[model samples]
Target: VSVQLYANYAIGKDVQAMKAVVGEEALSSEDLLYLEFLDKFERKFVAQGAYD
Candidate 1:
């Protein structure tokens, strides 16, 4: 499982810096879906105690 705080920070950082630099205008439909998927995945990761 992934560390919850670390995962949250990583996602936030990606959206803020990397996404902005890429000039992504806005989140694509796939990006939104991926974010949701990541959310669920991260939750499971935490629950599974695989997070560090």
Candidate 2:
């Protein structure tokens, strides 16, 4: 459930939203891994849309 929410926000390019959703919890190492992915994904996502 949380992962789904994180993915949605990440794909939507909403880093703040993703952070807000996940920041309240005590993140596990696995969750940290996903956050790193989110950072990269958001960067790529914005870059891909920059020309549009």
Candidate 3:
């Protein structure tokens, strides 16, 4: 799920879903590994558009 979400966000697929998930997890979690994964996802990928 995490990887899929990350990929989707990075590639500009399901952005609303990704944003919702990120918001939800970011607001309501203290789990270190989970948070780390979110952080990694945020930093590890960038979505590029047709115009750059």
Best candidate, TM-score: 2
- State the C-alpha lDDT per candidate: 0.60, 0.60, 0.50
What ranking emerges by TM-score with the best candidate at the front?
A: 2, 1, 3
The 10 consecutive residues of candidate 3 with the worst lDDT sum are 24-33
Global CA lDDT of candidate 1, please? 0.60
Steric clash pairs (candidate 3): none
TM-scores for candidates 1 onward, in order: 0.42, 0.42, 0.32
lDDT of 2 by residue, 1-52 (tens): 7688566656544444555777726556565666667666567654586475
Determine which window of 10 residues in candidate 2 has minimal summed lDDT.
Answer: 9-18
Point out the worst 10-residue segment of candidate 1 by lDDT. Answer: 12-21
TM-score, predicted candidate 1 vs. hidden true structure: 0.42
* TM match of model 2 to true structure: 0.42
Candidate 3: tens digits of C-alpha lDDT, residues 1-52: 8678765444443333455667544543434344455456666544445565
lDDT of 2 at 12: 44
Candidate 3 regions exceeding 4 Å error are 1-30, 46-52
